[model samples]
Target: MKITVSNWFKSGSPWVWLNAGAVAVSVVMVLGLLALIAVRGLGHFWPTAIVAADYTIPGNSQVQVMGQIADVEEIPAQRLVDAGLPKPGNKALIDRQLIKVGNRDVSGSDFVWVVKPWLQNVSHPKDAIALERREWGNFYGFLKDVRQNGSVVASGTEAWAALQDSIERAEDIYSQIYKIEKKEIGHINSGLERLRLKERSLELKGTNTPEALADIAASRAVLDAEYKVLEKELGDLYAAFTRDSIQAQTIDNNIVDINVSKIVRAYQPNAMGFFGKVGFYGDKIWEFVSDDPREANTEGGIFPAIFGTVMMVIIMSIIVTPFGVIAAVYLREYAKQGFVTRVIRVAVNNLAGVPSIVYGVFGLGFFVYFLGSHMDQLFFPEALPSPTFGTPGLLWASITLALLTLPVVIVATEEGLSRIPSTVREGSLALGATKAETLWRVVLPMASPAMMTGLILAVARAAGEVAPLMLVGVVKLAPSLPLDGNYPFLHLDQKFMHLGFHIYDVGFQSPNVEAARPLVYATALLLVIVIAVLNLSAVAIRNHLREKYKALEI
Candidate 1:
């Protein structure tokens, strides 16, 4: 072989060959992400649609669970956004509660509202329901009733649905009232005409004229009173019809008697746009997300879990970043290279090596039952015995994660600081810049990219680490979200829902294991997406900071 001048273009050394292998790894990673996303997303599209039969429920009532069919509303993409509420406008558009029953076309406005994930052959379907009764009703028929009103209440889908039965009933009543009012008024008018004719006859009377006048006058007065009553009734009818006060919601009386006035209950397709429904795929997605925060199958949706995840991550980041950065700065710039530094370095590295499950045990023992219970006694006395800080809290979870990831942040930050030249620091001191000022302005900026990278990695690792969180902050189900409808309502003490736990519960602890498998894939897809998003954000930030520093490199 010719000993050509060695260059990158022609290099065949093992290191160069390894560099080439990196390209293959990159290709594999990209393909893997794509394939996983497709598998999860398509799984959402092809959800099992199993129709449930009418089974006898408690109190001798029968509930029918149709099946879990493609909602026609479910769309594509992995990693679903949070589905946490019963919000009215576009907010409720993401709910995948509507099922595509039989040949029903969901794209057009014509539909019958059906319960999502139509429960099939369950001993009890009530245990899985999150909303009021969902039965077959003509969604289009309700719209027709609204057209007769020619108002928002008339033309509106939800509004008409809300009062469909009442509107139809009101229309009927008004029709009857229209005929009765006309007939009663006609009768009264005729009576008045007869009374006038009688008066004329009395005036023409000879011996009996005066006696007839008194009797006729008495009859006329009674007829006039009757006319007044009819007029008032007509007026009341018109007023009631005009204000839409008489419109009522109609459901299968056989199913539920939802009093629209006193205790109004409404069904809504809990999703919006084409894509959102596509993501929701089958009603099972809806079933998977919803719950009352206690039962496993309740359709309250994974709102609590989402809130917990975001809130905990934010808290963890806040706690870990400053502390980790400060420790790194002190070790790199201020601490003498003696026993203290050596000891700290060993401790920091050792902390990283410790198993994550150990941290969870620590959190549960020290944080939950001990520290949290103590705080419950002092600060939240009213909520005591319930264990405020003593229980798994988002705050505690965040703190726990912060503790677990601190070493990674510190190590990365210290390495970044060490890369800064000693000459630069000496020059800064010679230029009369204080150590603190130089470190703050020059050192930190240079090290920020690395710190951010560390944080990114920490977030990626922490978000996926279910074992530690399983012990500390996360719960199988949270009753109310950590945030709620109270004054200054974001409660840190509250236990939170988590997607990881959902995967665990659905995969292992669920009664309907076969039904829950698709959900497990969907959840796994979501977790992967969440991790990717965090990592991508870090990569973007690092790139931007690197660009900013490149100009300073010369």
Candidate 2:
């Protein structure tokens, strides 16, 4: 038996089992981490019940506290005593609860921590509505009355019904206002700026004729008249939106009139059925995916970050694929296998190990400063001192990332090219095919799956890259998307938001850490999903190509 066991170890069976165990452990750890992130991130959208309770503090009067239970923890009773709180008799641990008593404008803070030992009479109040606002985080209060133009329009049970109706109208109006201001007004502004630039250009050429000046003036007048009409319409919309308000009694027993226009949605989580909660959860998820961020990025959605990340990746892919493929083709196929080639290969491999921030600094100095400054001087002198292309933007960011990931693509493609049988190339040449033709028609096609593998790897690296992007183009809060209804439709010169940067900003830079924590998890999860989707797409394409050329290679 001892000899058999020793033979098994000598035969490497034990080593095989050890390696397998290691892999299994690694997979389990990754899955566990993902499960944790998913639970913490996705659970944030659930409609948690609002609790109304009388919180009693030792040596102080009791006050009514109302809000959603955000978190709970157990602390040493001695710590509470050290903080000047009267100790509970012989208790080693005391429970503490974090309540999200939002109504920041009224309560002066969005969250508060209360000791559970001093609390009593906690109840979930169905009438306590949680208001998601467009401005100040959220409001937890009881609906008392609905007012219109400073008059009481509805009160008691009727107020809830009235509030619902008013919010629908306000949201509709808000959409219209957004369209007019962002679309109509924005177009006019662009047109006006272009005309100014055109006139300036003509002046520089000493061709600022009276007729040209008159034509520009005529266009300006037309745009001005259009702007006035939109301005008046916008004013009317604002007035109508602010006309209705709801009188709500907060947890602290203070009455405040909240404008209906500011309220995004109102819900009584305690009153919601299971199905109602599900529907609410779905809506919250949609809002997180579709809406723009607000309230210092502690509230609202991250649509811009999503859009920017996807768009940047697409742009980077476009820029990187061709350049990387061409470089690899030259190095592996055309270049002689000599000392110079070896040196170049070594340099390419070394670049892959360089820190990403080093790339950021290089991108900022070379792409944004050197190349962009030259382009602005030549093409956009009219916008000089202000800097058009002479700034970090989508184009520079894409180019920078393309350069950063170029080595991966080059190395992968070279490996693919090297794997092809020499006989395949020789056979093509023997069959009246030139080297170029053989490479283009036969070698490249068989190598396509490998090239796609490189692209998948490139995208995986680029999608989560935050450091380089910060110096290149990523911003905390981009006012508009890089792609829009504006002229040219895709503005490569615009600075854009990014999911990785959003996670970084919200996680570390936010003023409200507690509120932003869940968002960080959510955004991180979203970024992982985005990268996975991109890689899966590339992998699918690669699989198809591999199957198509399998017989050819054989």
Candidate 3:
């Protein structure tokens, strides 16, 4: 029997094949994108060999260049000529390389582009050093001497080991200094602020008696004493931290002195073997995830951003789930199927399509200004003018996201509630169960999977949202996590960092474009992973709920 093409079309086979092919293509594209992001982002951690070379342009003196090869690209020779650089030969296209010369304090730039044809006698020197610093970006050079108290203690090859030892000592001192300044001193400052607020509150209430004043003064004195001790300790640490210094020679043979305390890590990349490079890569990856961002977010770790993002999503989930479920229940089980109900449903659906920035603006107006200002007046009048809750913060950001995602939850839950067989409700009624009891004991339980489905979708969308968070709470840098070891451990009123905003800042707002570009990809990959993890958690719960209720469906 011959099968006609028309008959095959009529059988819907062509449509099925078309759909499968389309889905396959989409899957491949998504995987390809992820692969590209992973390669570009993860590759940044691998230490590349630093190349030292003499570069000369036509009729110009040769200049020494030393740094890691950051990027290589081919462009039309005309483009280089337009920039007043001599074109090489008659080639239409030429390759150029971006070199990270480091020594930003001396050169005033982190990177430089050089035409490949002009580079001569490139070599990777074994003694060359790459120093990652806390400021002024990286430094690439050769160690000359190690100094203690401005006196030379070690020179030549001995300086390398001495430099490492001094770095370790400085790091130990820095750890103590960090603890005192950021934690102990910070705690003392908070205490003083609280005391001041207490005194203010008493004055406001007409209870600023002499005894109260005495007690407040005593507390202030104690805090002041503690701060003084910490200040002395910090001074001593800083003195010690600046004691050790290293002299190094740049590729141009210029000698410079760098304080040991400023260096985060130093390594000889050209001398490292495969295993050594692997270890270095692992350490870099760890630092990226665990350390706080530095250098306008072009360097350091994004731990704070990760923390804020997760905390906001969790808070949003807690607030939205119950409210969404309640609204869905009322609409699906109790509300009359009238014009108002239909209109409300239409409005809910329409809200899901609104731009996210609109929700941010609404949150700023309604949630932050109006509601938060009222809250401050009612409960925190002593902290007035400071606007405790009347600002963009974690709570406002979470609530805004909850509102943005509420429609999804409502629709999903209503669908679940509607799927129940009428006979199930009838059986419950006949069994003498009240409507509320039926909903509590059976209906909601059976519909939990769908609610979770909604939550999963909500999280997936909310975690990746940048615009709404930017207005409500996210910032370029957050000095502390929203959660900390302070009183009222979780401060919902505090502004916090977020991964989405970090990516935006690093990609678009950073001053060092070459340094920040790789980080942008890294941060984007991290955001995708975070959203995935949140969704997968919800999905796991949803699958469990579905399995538990499978028998009831029959």
Candidate 4:
């Protein structure tokens, strides 16, 4: 039997095929994007061999260059000619290489572009070293000597091993210093501040008695003594940290002395084998996830950003879920189905389409400025003028996101409630079950999967939101996390870092574009992973709930 085209259309097979094709295309696109992101981002951790080359400009003498080849591209010869660069004869396209010459303090630039035709005698020297620093970016050179107290203690073949030993010592000292400065000293400072605030509160209440003053003074003295002890320990550590230095010879043959404390790691990339490179890559990836960021967030780990993002999402979930469920129940189960109810539903749906930044503005005005200011005035008057609760912070950011995603939860729950057979309600009523009891014991449990579905959507949306968070609380860098071991533990009033904001800052706001570029990709990939993990957790819970209630659906 011949199938007519009209009959095929009538059978809906064409539409089904079209939909499947569209879905296939979409999945492929998504996977392709993820693959691209992974390649660009993850590859940044791998150590590339440093190339030592002689580069000659069109009208200048040959110059020695040492660095890793960061990127290579072909550009139209005409474009180079237009920019007053002499084009190599008869070539339509010129291949240019971007070299990351990381002695930023000396060369004044992290990267330089060189035309391929002008590069001569390129070789990777075995002795060449790449130093990852805590500041001034990376340094590419050769180790000359290891110095102790400005005197050469090790040189020639012995220098590398000695340098490694010194770096280990310095790192240990550095860790101690970090603990003292960031944790012990920090705790003391917080205590002092609280004491000061208490004193101020007493004064404000006209209770500044001599006994109260004595108590405050005694507390301040104890804190001051602790700080002094930490200060002395920090000084000793710093002295040890700066005791050793390394002399490195740059491409220009100039020897520069770098303190051991400033160096994060030094490696001879040219001498590394595949396994060595793999080990180095693993270390770099670990550092990216575990270390604190340095150099305007272009370098170091994004652990703080990851922490803040997860914490905010969790807080937002906690706040939005119950409120959303309640509102949904009221609308679907109790409210009369009339013009007012329909209007309310319409308004809720429309809100889901509103621009996220608008929610930020509303949250700032209503939640932060008005409500938060009132909260500060009422409860935290001692911390007044500092704007404790009356500021953009973790709590405000979470609340803002909760509000932004509330409509989704409400709509989803209402739909779930609507899907229950009316006979289920009738059966419950016939069995002498109260409405509240039925909702608590039967209705809500069955609707939990839908609620979880709504939460998944909310998290997927909220986790990726950068614009609202920017206005509410997210910052370029947060010194401390919102949740800490401090009193009242989860300090919701603290401003915090976020992966989304970190990506934006690294991508756009950084001074070193070349250095920051790879980091942008890495951060974006991490943010996507974080969102996926959060969503998957919710999805798993949702699936479990659905399976648990499957028998009751009839």
Poorest 10 consecutive residues of model 2 by lDDT?
1-10
Cα error, residue 192 of model 4, in Å, equals: 0.9
Query: Global lDDT for candidate 1?
Result: 0.61
Looking at model 1, which ten-residue stretch has the lowest summed lDDT?
134-143
In candidate 2, clashing pairs total 0
User: What is the overall TM-score of model 4 with all chains considered together?
Assistant: 0.98
lDDT (CA) per prediction: 0.61, 0.92, 0.94, 0.92
Which candidate leads the pack in lDDT? 3
List candidate 2 segments past 4 Å from native. 1-3
- Per-residue C-alpha lDDT of model 2 across residues 98-172, encoded as one tens digit per residue: 999998888788899998867789899879899999887899989999999989999998888899899999999
Candidate 4: how large is its RMSD?
Answer: 1.1
Stretches > 4 Å off in candidate 1: 1-15, 22-26, 46-300
Across 296-393, the per-residue lDDT of candidate 1 in tens digits comes to 53222455565566677777888999999999999988899999899999999999989998998998888888888888777655543456577787
lDDT-wise, the better of 2 and 3 is 3
TM-score of each: 0.58, 0.98, 0.98, 0.98
Which digits, one per residue and each the tens of the lDDT, describe model 3 over residues 237-270? 8999899998999999899999999999999999
For candidate 3, what's the RMSD? 1.3
